[model samples]
Target: MSNSANHIISVSDLKKIYIRGSEHIHAVDGITLDVNQGDYTAFVGPSGSGKTTLLHLLGCLDNPSAGVLTVEGKAVYDKGKFMNERELTKLRRDLFGYVFQKFYLIPTLTVKENILLPFAFYRKAEADKTADRLADLLGLSHRLSHLPKELSGGEMQRVAIARALINKPRILLADEPTGNLDSKRSEEISDIFCKLNREEGLTIILVTHNHALAESAGKMVELKDGKLI
Candidate 1:
């Protein structure tokens, strides 16, 4: 990875509480963590153990009820002149790239257009070159004309990965990225992630329930009751 060992995401005494009627549910309780730059880490937990909730907070999709989160050395929402909507949107657009279980490509668009879609909102002169390079590396040079509906599941997910990397994000956040694929496809995707981590210095955070699958990660963090175990 980057190998700088500098912290990219730091969470301090983070807590998330949900109010249901009169009862308070503590989804995350005083969880503090640091994710180094270019880390390839996996988060594992049982259902309702707050793995997803914690990921949302770390990814800046949600605000924590208490404690502090600093992303890229800036204080998170509303703390010390914290990020406004414009800044948050910019951060999301410029810093984090997301991959989910579903390959959410537009059904009507061909693979090339789908990969080039995000650049339409924010263009860089090098965008096309980057897309072309990733396409070659991902073995999708031949599928450029295929539509999302016309591709197989693994093919679709590979397109999704290419789309996510188009911006060359600071962190790649994946929530069970291989959840929709078969075992062979899962292994293939895992190898791609490992390649990203090693070759491109991508910081990847994955949340998965499969222990056998999670071991592929360099560092594995287990969550129990929303706290690291």
Candidate 2:
């Protein structure tokens, strides 16, 4: 583990491979990149280009089959070893907030409940206060008590965004955040991401096929056939 002054994440020769009975699929093949503090990076590529796979590796949601990955300058994966699950959980809990395309909120949980769900895994004394603030920020204050089924698709995605922010993570990892929304809703979500990166100074890394959203990023990385293009 090394200390990085500005580089929040550094990857070297990263690769993720899946093996079938007789085939080896190289989902992410030998890609190296760096994400600095306050960087809004979008991984954009066509389907099966390994954009999502690379994002997963960066977020520690999935482990790399081979390569080096350092977060905040400390090696998470190096020399054929990766951090244990507990350490990885701590790393994720402390540093990353993830928003997915599906808006994975529990149907039974209200907006507020869904937002504060992270507290169940990691205790935070200001959980309620944070949730309220995020709700207001995302314009979901009025829907805090509503169930997921009662909200529109955009509203549900906002709830998911609020839930991700409730942990006060330094890095926001989003995968196809606007994939389920219409154009208008997609633009709204895009604006929200821009605000989060510009105003909040959050380091954002997102995987998207939406070129417009990808264009809003400070850095755009295109992938093809599992490698940087």
Whole-model lDDT per candidate: 0.85, 0.90
Best by lDDT: 2
lDDT of 2 by residue, 1-229 (tens): 3335788999999999999989999999999988999999999888999988998899988989999999987788985898887888889898999999999999999999999987644446578888888888899989988999999999999989888888789999999999999988988899999999999999999999888899999999999999999
Where does candidate 2 clash, by residue pair?
none
Poorly placed runs, candidate 2 (over 4 Å): 1-4, 120-125
lDDT of 1 by residue, 1-229 (tens): 4332498998888888999999998898888888998789999988888888888888888878888888888778433245677878888888888888899999999998888888744456588888888888787999999889888888899899999988888899888888898888888788888889999899999998766568988899988897889
TM-score of each: 0.91, 0.95
**Residue 70, candidate 1: alpha-carbon lDDT:** 83
Query: Which pairs of residues collide in candidate 1?
Result: none
